[model samples]
Target chain A: MAASMLKVAVGSRAYSSGIRDVLWKLGRLNHVAIAVPEMEKARSFYRDVLGAQVSEPVALAEHGVLTVFVELGNTKLELLEPLGPESPIRGFLQKHRDGGMHHICIEVDHLPDAIQQLRQRQIRTLSPEARIGAHGKPVIFLHPKDCGGVLVELEEA
Target chain B: MAASMLKVAVGSRAYSSGIRDVLWKLGRLNHVAIAVPEMEKARSFYRDVLGAQVSEPVALAEHGVLTVFVELGNTKLELLEPLGPESPIRGFLQKHRDGGMHHICIEVDHLPDAIQQLRQRQIRTLSPEARIGAHGKPVIFLHPKDCGGVLVELEEA
Candidate 1:
């Protein structure tokens, strides 16, 4: 594995050593997530109207949401419906009412390296550590505040 | 150069003939667009904080937005800032305050065929016709209402 040290300059100080982090290895975008008030409506729309194949809704109780995948040639569209009143998506749906685009997931070669690099640059990650995502892969979320109000998920490629 | 026919069944009608639409030719997602209130702040955040290579901001007068590309290994992050008070992004920024993800662009092999397919399915497209996009490629947008509240842009690959 090739590793490169990144010299990050913060304000007046130059924090240089031990930055033996791998170069940015985040890969292809896996999918774009959409928050919806109703999953079946969104699913039928894509399947019947858009002529796209959609997966059956799967409930990820741990994540507090029901998820469905709209299969595309290159990437997938994930529909998220809050499973409970306390689900995070419920808050988003309340604001949008009609629902709206949510977070995006990208594949990464090395999650640990990516997280370390982000932390070194003072970017706050949401989860304390990586967790299994709907795809059954290790994933981590970055705080939207740091990414211009865009929630980003990094998953193992 | 490859085409496949999709036999879609609508209410009381089975449209099977001339289904010679291109098989979901859209390739890997090219980028996800994020609307921001400030260009320089967002640019610096992705460049300095995220350790990503950011492009110089470019203004698209026709679109009424200034755009910047954050280059990643397999995809890109597009930052959009409204050019004037009348810009569409201005309204989004007003409502979101902190700005938010706007849309996602995907690459398609045959743009005309894709548009035709969408029309056959009765999905509303934004630009009555394909127009030049940020990448100077023929692109068109599908209405968010038709896409489960996600603004989807299809660009010629």
Candidate 2:
């Protein structure tokens, strides 16, 4: 894990980490999520037109989403559809009728530590606590306002 | 390659392969592009804050944007900042303010054939001809309306 600490380039005051908190490291991008108005159409487009291996739709009722995974060689594209009236995606779709890119999910080594460290750096999260994500892992969403207008989800690896 | 296919699950009528036109395939996702209002801050956030290996900013004068790459091991996140008033990113930033997810680039084995086939399927493109992308590859932007409100870029591999 010392290699993780060494990743902070030399002479960088941006981190201010004389403490060397190597407890967590951000990992590979898990998926780029797109909220689609039509789930089956999006699934067929990626699987058949794009010729990518796509997974069957999984309903994450707890997450208020129906997800279909489109497997790219390096990463994945998650197509999400609103499951219920109260789904967050429903509001997003109302604003963007044709649907649009929703958010991005990246893997993190430690969720709790990352959250604490991010908050210290003035990054606000959408929720007060971590919740189980679509992948059934501890996940928390950083506020898009804090993340340069992009909704970012950090999931435990 | 035939192996590029065989990924399509059975019972997909999307391709309409009565003529068996398998001339091109969509490959890996190239990158997810995000237009940021502030380049230096966005660069530092991904690098020092997220602890990712980030690339130096590259100015694309022809493209009218400055680009910084955040390498996520498996893929990349492209942070773009507008270079001039005429830049397309300028418009994006004006709308998003803090910055937002722009477009996703996907690789294709053959660009021309994919464009033609996509046109046949009623997929509208922003331009009739492919242009040189930031990576110096032939790329075309698919119309967002046709793609469920997602601006998709197809780059030739």
Instruction: Name the best candidate (by TM-score).
Output: 2
DockQ for all models:
0.27, 0.39
Model 1, C-alpha of A56: deviation from truth (Å):
3.2
Cα miss at B22, model 1 (Å)?
5.8
Give residue B97's lDDT in candidate 2 (0 to 100): 95
Q: Give the per-residue lDDT digits (tens) of candidate 1, residues B126-147.
A: 9799999988899999988777
CAPRI classification of candidate 1: acceptable
Q: What does candidate 2's lDDT look like per residue over A1-157, in tens digits?
A: 2223333442332221223355678899999999999998887677666667777788888778998888777888899999987788999998888989999999999999999988877899999999988776999999998888999999999
What residue pairs clash in candidate 1, if any at all?
none
Q: Considering only chain A, what is the TM-score of each predicted structure?
A: 0.84, 0.86
lDDT of 1 by residue, A1-157 (tens): 2323455543333332222344656577788899988887887666554556566678999899998776665677789999976787888888788778889888878888888878876778998999999978999999888877889889999
Task: Please give the distance, in angstroms, between residue B29's alpha carbon in candidate 1 and its true position after superposition.
Answer: 2.4
What TM-score is obtained by chain A of candidate 2?
Answer: 0.86
Give a tens-digit lDDT track for model 2, residues B42-117: 9777866777777778899888999987877777799999997789888878889999999999999999999988
